[model samples]
Target: MNTWQQAALAAEIENQAQVPVLSLAASASVRPSRRLGRPTLIQMGSNIYEQVRCISAIVRSYHWRGVIAIYEDDAYGGNAEMLTLFSEALQRVGSEIEYHLSLPPISSLSDPRESVYQELLKLLSTQSRVFIVLQSSLPMATHLFQEARRMDFMGKDSAWIITDSISSFLDSMDTSVIPYMEGALGIKSYYSKSNRPFLEFSAQFQKNFKSENPEENNTQPGIHALRADDSIAVIARALERLASDDTNTPKMMLKNILARNFSGLSGNIIFEGGDLSNSNSLLFRIINVVRTGYKELDFWTQDLDNPFRREGRDKNSSRNTTKVLDGPVIWPGYLIKRVPKGWEMPTDAKPLKIGIPAKTSFDKFVKVDEAEAEADKRYSGFCIDIFREVLKILEQNYSLPYEFHPVIGTYDELVDFVYNKVITPISSL
Candidate 1:
């Protein structure tokens, strides 16, 4: 199926018609039926469980209580379901989504980049700076991020976490879009490239694939391709175990497949509960994008406690398991230190009112020129000048709004007013 939702719906329809189906697609296992002999799913895509664990670990490490979620619209079939899984993962770690936004499919929108910018602006209007993006393809991710950079949303205070569906194909992404993706953190499927079996399969597959499709030149086989080959092997092996004369029913074939085990190009091919067995082979790698491309910052497996260890180091030592990265990450704005706090005050908060002493003995230092005949009034003093300078400095970091309010009382009265009230009081003695 072309879309995740369509694939799932097709499976359900085939099941109702009593036709057994074995699905080899990315989003088929997004929400699988637990009932036996319904549809056997051979996942050739990213698993939602591992994604949940990896992203939750990063969010917890940063101590972010809330974030905004942006995803492709459900017209793509499985986007909504993926978002549900994301929300559940955040809730499990005592964190939550502050807001969730949906972007229309690229084909449906006249200008997808403009759509992304509008949605991104809505995200910026909120207090949350941390964003979790769920997309099905690399190009769509590039489109969204390019717009984010244009809006100045990709800054030192911003944090972006992307799922495997988008990140797995980073090596093949267009170079023009790579600059906009710098400082982004992504989760991707992992396999040991150094393994002899994997290397042998990769070489042969690349050679054979090029020979068969000469016109489709300069192509490289990705994880999905390897999984496709393995999926066929699994079905073929299951067919071999079936009796030559026995009926090839869907249920019978599923039983035979589940009972068998084999090794494939990427890793061991096994299934549990209609999905791939998530053991050592169901691994994930977290990467940070830089000017050059991306670098592996952390590795995670089902059995590892210390997921973030220095590269080339095999075992854990004394580092805290909860710390997400092995070393410092280069954030947006080329910052190499200081983790972002993930949220800021919205632009709608009330302005600060600074109470100033109007009736003061020192007119040069503090003076409030009040128009007795009219409602207009003005204030000027050395203290007022200093306050304005400090506010200017704060403008660089914060969107603070403040104004000096002339107090019609003595310094002691102003002090008493500030003591009883919440407004900040200033004086020039």
Candidate 2:
């Protein structure tokens, strides 16, 4: 039932039966052609595009230039659209997806642990340490992170950012799996807990939930549960409005439901184009996973134009101009305060070899003095000085390991050496 195919089939069956479908979990963007000029399915959940915008803002805030995308592979084209959305979102923030690692649904694999371990091994070969997980279920995400931690992928230089798919259900996950995913960041739909209706509902829900499922430890309802309550509220309101009219056709009910707008448990319940509109009231909470659970770092709202502003912060304050998170984050592994660079060099990577001409007419531009001891050879010139200074500046921010090698060849030979991969690109005077 997690796949789009199953959801589509369910929707089709409901449409044929002339029943209105209110989905609380599915957020796939259905094509207009499939709707046939009228929509049968009304998604009460938050929009995926809005989630993408929040994630883009986080990437910008961290200054990560590239990230690897890890997502569940779906055969029914649902994940394809997700990848396209993520790619476009990252591009808008001056970042791009460096690699896409598709994991099969955990149910499809015979040995999920081995499968995840093999996948993590493939990622170790790449330089991108920043990972964005999309469309992953709780079980799959837990196993993936467990394998990642086992393989040392959750080190200080690494970062993991998860979308709402897994974040929404973090409360229900087993506490044993949390250690593997500590220091990860996630975004989930926000709701007002202080509201009277929600507070009363939460109290009643806990009592009923514990009574029905005694073995379950966490009785707190998640975002989907809140949305389900709101969905029912929406239908009840629509039915009340239609009580005056004798004719309550499916189309009429749909119209009435779409026309009604009010504040509900999951924020402003407003529908446009058969889905929840991206309104200012709809907010996403940014969370950082700690040893004891996750902490709310900040909130992202459309009203602020995608910045991660703190709750109750002044709207007109000039100090909040930058799109930065308000609190410090416990980054991956041992680095609690230091931010990850989002990438790292491979352990076996060789130092960059810069080839310089052995003989030059203008010693001022390029000169190489060969000593009796080959190891004592001296290299000096305006270009070498400039290169040394540039390396010094770069080393201040990056660990750029490089060495100079004098090549006994003409200018043409040096160019050929670069073209043939024999030497790295050389800067000319």
Query: What are the per-residue Cα lDDT tens digits for candidate 1 across 321-415?
Result: 45658657877667677887787643445455567777888888877877654422366778777777897898898887655577776778787
lDDT of 2 at 46: 59
Tally clashing residue pairs in candidate 1. 1
Candidate 2 collision pairs? none
Top model by lDDT, which number? Answer: 2
Which residue ranges in model 1 land beyond 4 Å of their true spot?
16-31, 35-37, 40-42, 76-81, 205-220, 242-245, 303-321, 344-429
Model 2, TM vs. native: 0.82
- What is the lDDT, from 0 to 100, of the residue 20 in candidate 1? 39
Query: Whole-model lDDT, candidate 2?
Result: 0.76
TM-score, per-candidate, Cα-based? 0.73, 0.82
How well does model 1 score by local distance difference test?
A: 0.69
Candidate 1 weakest ten by summed lDDT? 28-37
lDDT of 2 by residue, 1-429 (tens): 565445555777777556667766556563321343336777776556677777877888788888999988766667777778878888888888888999987879999999999887788656679998877878899889988888888889999988888888876666677777898999988888899988898899889988987876667778888888888888998899888778878877877888889988778888877777666553788899887778888888774354566778775432232356766888788576768888875332656667778778889987887663563237778998898899899878667776666666678978677545454344432
